[model samples]
Target chain A: MPTDVRLPENDLLALALDFLLSHGLNAPQGHSLARMLVDAQRDGSFSHGLQRLPGTLNTMKHPRFNRHADPAPESVSPAVVRVDAQFGFSCLAAERGIDALIGKAGTIGIGLLAVNNGFHSTALWPLVERIAAAGLVGLSMNPTHAWVAPAGGTKGLLGTNPLAFAWPRKGKPPYVFDFATSAASRADIAMHRNAGREIPDGWGLNGQGECTTDPAEVLAGAMLPFGGHKGSAIATMIELMAGPLIGDRMSRQSQDFDHGADAAPCHGELLLAFSPDIIGGAGVGEGAERLFAGFSDQGARLPGDRRYRMREVSARDGIAVSSALLQKIRSQTA
Target chain B: MPTDVRLPENDLLALALDFLLSHGLNAPQGHSLARMLVDAQRDGSFSHGLQRLPGTLNTMKHPRFNRHADPAPESVSPAVVRVDAQFGFSCLAAERGIDALIGKAGTIGIGLLAVNNGFHSTALWPLVERIAAAGLVGLSMNPTHAWVAPAGGTKGLLGTNPLAFAWPRKGKPPYVFDFATSAASRADIAMHRNAGREIPDGWGLNGQGECTTDPAEVLAGAMLPFGGHKGSAIATMIELMAGPLIGDRMSRQSQDFDHGADAAPCHGELLLAFSPDIIGGAGVGEGAERLFAGFSDQGARLPGDRRYRMREVSARDGIAVSSALLQKIRSQTA
Candidate 1:
């Protein structure tokens, strides 16, 4: 019955890794995916957590999927590196490029890594957290298949198009957040749908290209860009930076590449690292402290603070997994 | 009695220059300020246009103002330049550093110019437009005096914290937009107040830390950050990037430096330029065309299209200045 099992952090990670390994993934590949899932679960991002495993496993051995693809870093320039992900998921690709990108930023004050032919249906916080931990500022942008409409138009011309930035502070958790340019992320909409709740106005448009508050219609149609035109512009910016700029397919092109396949949706990401020490002089630490002060003056929660707090709590008490998800995950592991 | 007066663009530029020169500014300094004002007016950005001159004139002759000071570009590294704006207007400083910044970006694939001790109560479009004209991507951010509160906090601790990004396309106006990280820009509130209208909810909070639709109360209280916590986080990001990271003052610190004086607000801006040909590969042109295709398919308006269209008409047909503004300008010129 599974009965809504609560598993220790290590056990969850082991289970995910074992499940992935049985599906033709190498140990390192399995480890990368497992770490991403466990980290998301521990951080209270349940949508990106274990619930995603079953869908991912179904695609892991897709006939057209490159199960053994290995991403290798190619230094396209002194400050830019391009990774050919060989049509694999980006978790392992990011793992392979993180050190190389950081090393380049250390020397040149900045570094850019482009991940082409990769898919990332995962939160970007992990890589950004690592970058910040290494005392560098990190910025990332990526595109999934298109689901968001442009500001004035009803047709979906862009992806939700997430962008992330992170800054590190000594003896404290890094300031980090990854946000979709859409008014609401897919997960938020999914939660509303599951609850049989109406979404807020401006959350999305119906398939008929009209505004609607029904979660189901929005899921079946298009998401609205957040902050109106400003949000749309950013999504376009992300499209350029992560798509053709990186010599990869844009969202629409990726859609064509996969022919609307949910399994192995081909997408791409752009990751950038900047060494605050070189670019910001010695004022980086002082600057971050002052910002912290402002946040405290108003009890403003820093971005990613909630996630860090949740991580600690989950690590201490374990993560609660839904019975349905646990049951499905167990079958895959078996 | 003066009526709404339309004046030729050159005439307006000359008039502004004359007014600044009369305030003891050198020819170059006067021209710098005048150019910014005329450009803003030409683009139909009335708030940043002629309406701002009187306050600027008062600041020009303040006892604490550094009249003869000029910012010079100091290349700190191959990819970064620092400009100490010398407690003067940033129009001239931006003018002085644009060439150096562009050249560096052309060489190194990217350039960062940090403007410290400068005032820029004008639209940032002209500079970004120039960068785009040179076939590069441009990004700018700055913090002025505090006017926006962090999300969930009653106290205002940040500026509107505007961010601008521009991307150039061949044979077309650049895709450019600038946005304040507040729920509503200061100008929007001012317009509502002028029109004797109440603002929408969530625009601002009264002094008592309660939401209010009254523009007067909002002006007396705090402006809400746009998009809730996400907006607050971005404002914080801008605060760090434009303030301590640039070796200058944060929004609150700038407010303190001004001591509530309007004269030379002592704010700063962060400018970055990236060459698409270098970082975005050789397919950038084709890529941009594809983006335009997407926009055309959906009939989405490009961000800077209207402004560019306005500029062209203003250049040919002159700008319509309000009667009050015209009267004030005529008085200064006389």
Candidate 2:
């Protein structure tokens, strides 16, 4: 609700894409990154939106970084595909490989895509939502450098691993939600830090491993897993799934390997897509109807409902980018 | 802990098996049920242990029950199999179908087994743990009758859905745990109810839709999801996955179909097994090592570490069942 620079949706996306092009990304890569950034801004995920542009641009500027490198994930098995992003962004890799995953699941019932040496810097809902839109159940896990301590432990040994899940709904927007196994994703914390706002209590631990509500302190310290030990365990599972399971950098290694700037962080992601026709088969519609009906009976809003509503408003009235952020993005291209 | 009657491991197994046989279960089912029950006791899951044996016995006696069913699941797609338990205990069916699931995951990169028309009474850890023991990543989700309320709402619109995950460790008991998406499972609530103990705060709601600590009130009302909206979304996903995706009962339908006095509540389960060699390929060992190393670095115990330690003790010293429960089993025999 601060003072803002409001532009039409097209102009916002065009400016964002043009900024990415200024950083030497190809049209396809620019479009991919811009699309995710715009959606995040539209849905009010400011940290993952325009606020992240400068850092991503600085990271991509490294001499060792190659935005155009297409690792071209290979079919490792009938239902497995592996992509070695080789210190590049996962944006294009995911865009390139999701179709293969969908096709494999269509044929074999389920498909898995392992992404290694990638830097994924967006809210992952869009990726899985795309898979859901393709009429398949989609689930994704992405691990970053460690910032979460194991439950009842002192060290930050786990990633604030984020997971996304989506399934198709009959004649409606697909049901979807993305969450970090940790109390909050780093991006959410960063947003709080930028806003100079206090985060909710119990959201994180301080450097001394004591609970604190200061977003700045949390950024310097660690995150608490959402549901105590259970959340920590899931974070562990996701860390492995995105890390060594894909022959990629583990959270610990990624923390050590972080260059601070001019390079995407070394990390990984895992995605699974399951076809309704193959897995749900004859009962697909019935299952969807039952799920929606129950959700309605409780007057419980479905997960994707928020994003769907936000998308419509953003498309119509456009998104509000702060004047400060707009000036910063423009300065980046200067 | 309640006073118990210590019995030798062999004697306990023998008595439990005999008690199951008295209810007319075949030798295979008696062995399976007894094995799971004994393991539950061994692992200190008393709620899922011998405490609920009488209810199971009575349920199996229902005229609508079919204990001798051999629901040999049919292979739907290469990576998918569907088992209709044909209105019987899932013990024998799971025991019979597990090998096939492991084999399929070994052949393909991933395998999915859907079990419908089944009453799964035991803790699901044992099933997924078996898959992990076979050197695969195992994930299982089962949905039961309604007991959980959606986040932001107070109706029991969802099941106390349980999810289990396991991954193998080199030269170690597999790392695994199973958890209800609800704050606590229905069985856990029932245990507290029987003990006349107050449930923990945030565990459930009263009939008037207000939070309460009374287990009786929760039983009459609803259980809250473990991690607010996130857990509720996952539970919703599990409910649909185990129901329509598997051609079985959704939470509402199952609640209505449940024969109050006889037969285990009709429900369904979904299982996925992913072979490390097939999915992770050459990185399998690295993945396990990285995961275990993280736990060790933090002096953190893996999820199932307690179960493994207890199993050793139980195997050596045997489990202790309550004298009253023993008398009840004996009474059944008489």
Candidate 3:
């Protein structure tokens, strides 16, 4: 059993920042990355939160991703922009890109930003929420390492590319949805493997392309695409849009972290922001509010409401962490 | 077993259109609707193909949706347009919106269109493909009737909101992807029911909100969101964007089809078009071609490649439809 720990949000953020700083990251980079990770946990996405810190730190220690690097924005047009991550933390690059896009959209009613040459940023929902809270609709997608199989094939060929969307609703939290195109995530498979459990059929395959229950074989082979070919096609679309659209390496170009020489993970992200006011003209805000009220009346709960409530409870009661994981983190920090 | 019936592509399309016309749809409307449905089947997406036509026809007979109605474009801006579906076939309205947006985007580089007061439009991929084939990037989303359950809850509160995106690629089929936010589509549940098969756990729930394998339970309850809360959030976001953003009734304000009331089944759709030539200033076409080639090298296959191949095969051979389904369709038409 793991003991529950109650730390103030700010305290947790500062501690994370301190750890990053000690690992040679500058103040701005440390704080930005810390905020992203902490926000993921705060949003109840623990898998992408502090749990991912160790892997990120390991990558940072390698010389390929320089902590001192800065992302520079390249303007393609009034409505389009691109950012070169310079092998830095993806969280920082994503934040800059999102902020710039939101600002540009505020002026132009729509904006597009593409980020290239970066690492995995935390959960994408927080970025969506940030953009949505700014009174704009946000759409984002990113391609990562290969984990998911195509619809019919059994071998891994595509990343569990995640897509996210956010919509602002008056008097309610903005609805934020983020998900991988895979039927099951690598984390879920890892959990099953940790518990020596068998995965459900159709979730993944063995190395020989046959269905497998053993978590290890499934992990060694490929995770199935959600809803079969539909999901595979969607994931492929994300890869093309995020990878090639932004001029970054795609899944095949990605280095196998387990066997290849350590290299900067060349991930890419695409984001679009649109203002409802611009589209709806004069009474857009009022229209949105009225629409949301109608949905509430119809017994519709906002998408993120439950997660938000769970996060609030967790914050108030403190988060629970596995004892072994907590000990590992403490040892690393010490 | 499905018996293969060879038919030329043109012949299959003509036959489908003829079937629709015999059921009281006007020539243009029937042609548009038939093309959309046949395109789905040709692309190997049997669920959204002719399988849905019978239900759609049944809904059309309710008098709320006027099969002969025509959509009139309402210009919101030089680069923005709105269309009232006149409670008619959404396939017609959606195609019209796509054409209008593409035309506007050709001049402005970006076009946004919203469609309201429409009926179900099958397979969003075709619209995206149309936009992509026109040398533009396209994004679309729609909100439908409640069929998806929220993350933790077992009750139906949202439609299986589908999203589609496409991008122009050089020397290859344009990338096009379409998928619903649900773990499984209502069509999949119906298929299981027809087969007298038990569904997998987590696909849906019973009327009492308890998980069950009985396909009948799913029909009475709700389909689960893909990836739990993440998928639910996406559905909610889609509802917000597609519903209110397009000025349609939100989920709660939506009328139930079970009531057999004469109210129109309102559907909302959002379409966006972006021209690379406008965004990429000089050498835009070359840049796009280069990007496409680079992505293909990275194992990024075009989204619609498989479907296009399937269609080619079916064109060379013929469409394979189950005897039972064909007989059922013939009886309904007879």
Please give the fraction of native interface contacts (Cα pairs under 8 Å between A and B) kept by each candidate.
Answer: 0.44, 0.55, 0.12
> Model 1, A38-149: lDDT tens per residue?
8998898887788888888646654556678777887766677778777677888887888888988778677788887776658888888888889888888888777888
Q: For model 2, how does the per-residue alpha-carbon lDDT over B1-334 read when each residue is reduced to its tens digit?
A: 3636667777878988888888777787778888888888888777778766778876786666787876786787778887777777776677667777887888977888887777766889988889988888889987877888888777788888888998877787888979888988777788889989999997899988789999999989989998888888888888877777767788878767765754566787889888777666586676568757777776878889888887887777777678888888789773
Between candidates 1 and 3, the lDDT winner: 1
Question: Which of candidates 2 and 3 is the stronger one according to TM-score?
Answer: 2
CAPRI-style class, candidate 3? incorrect
lDDT of each residue in B1-334, candidate 3, tens digit only: 3545645567657766766777888776788888887788777887777766667666677657787878877776656778877778777887777778888777756777888777775878888888988988888888766777776676777778888998886776776777788888777898899999999987898897778899898888878877566566667777777776666755545546425553334677888888766654444445345434544554546556779898888877776555565556666763
DockQ of each: 0.55, 0.62, 0.21
The candidates, ranked best first by DockQ, are 2, 1, 3
lDDT of 1 at A123: 86
1 or 3: which has the higher TM-score?
1
> Across residues A4-119, which tens digit of lDDT does each residue of candidate 2 receive?
76677777788898888887777767787888888888877676787778888666876556677666878877888877766677777787788888888888888888877777
Model 3's DockQ? 0.21
